[model samples]
Target: MPDPAYRPAAPGDGRRCPRCGHRVSRYNDARHCSPCAQALRREADSCPRVHESTWAEPEVQSAIAARDFGALCRLVRGHAQLRQEDLAELSGLSQAFLSMLEQGNRRLTNIDKIIDLVNGLGVPAQLAARMFGRPG
Candidate 1:
């Protein structure tokens, strides 16, 4: 593969992927082309941080095995790839509130709040049920 660091044939022609050297349109000025960037994102997403394997950690797994929803909530957030601030933006909750909820200092007793968390974290319905129980 060509060196991504190689500059465009002409100085203003376009840019190349720093990692793979693939060329992309010059207008965007992105470091890596879209494809390469997507590939890198996929690679990063596959890491253990937010991947399924995170649920297998001893503490998280124990919480699942014991059906301890509060612990599960905390564990899930702790293992999530997005920071608490980012998650708060996605869930429309305050960071302090999310932290309190995750730490069990504040309860997640509201159905709406539970739904927001589940949607924001992409947690499956079955898993949410484990934490909040079924809605009447």
Candidate 2:
């Protein structure tokens, strides 16, 4: 992978993958390219703040930052109108883990895993923000 830091940064340029901050294929528009930005918006239910919040939160300073999956679950549950038990059964994530996530006691270890849950609930990545945070 090329070094994004070494790559030049400029206005209206594709910088890096905000989630992982990796240099995107197109650097002229920044990783928050149209596609990534749309993804972020969807992940937050068209609510950019939730997606934006992680960047400001203590432990979640970046799109790639660790998240409070528990809070995320509550959000998801509300968004999907599904009970935690139903989600647990559908995603095969243990009920305890689901409960932990609802309480913000744990965070997602893998985005793919969260994707599974999201898919099962018919939630869009826009709500998941393929890019977790905007790269500053």
TM-score quality measure for candidate 1: 0.47
lDDT score of residue 97 within candidate 2: 84
lDDT by residue for model 1 over 41-117, one digit each (tens)? 89877543345666557787567555554676567767775577766766767889878867778766677876776
Error at 77, model 1, angstroms: 3.4
Error of 1 at 45 (Å): 9.3
Put down candidate 2 lDDT per residue, 1-136, tens digits, no spaces: 4335545666566566667675555544344545665687687663212233333333322222234556655655554556777678667688888988677677777878776765554434554463355533
Give the 10-residue window scoring lowest on summed lDDT in candidate 2.
47-56
Candidate 1, which ten residues in sequence have the lowest lDDT sum?
Answer: 127-136
Model 1 accuracy (lDDT, Cα): 0.65
Model 1 misplaced regions, further than 4 Å = 1-49, 56-58, 61-70, 132-136
TM-score (all chains, Cα) for each model: 0.47, 0.41
Query: What are the per-model C-alpha RMSD values against the true structure?
Result: 8.1, 15.1
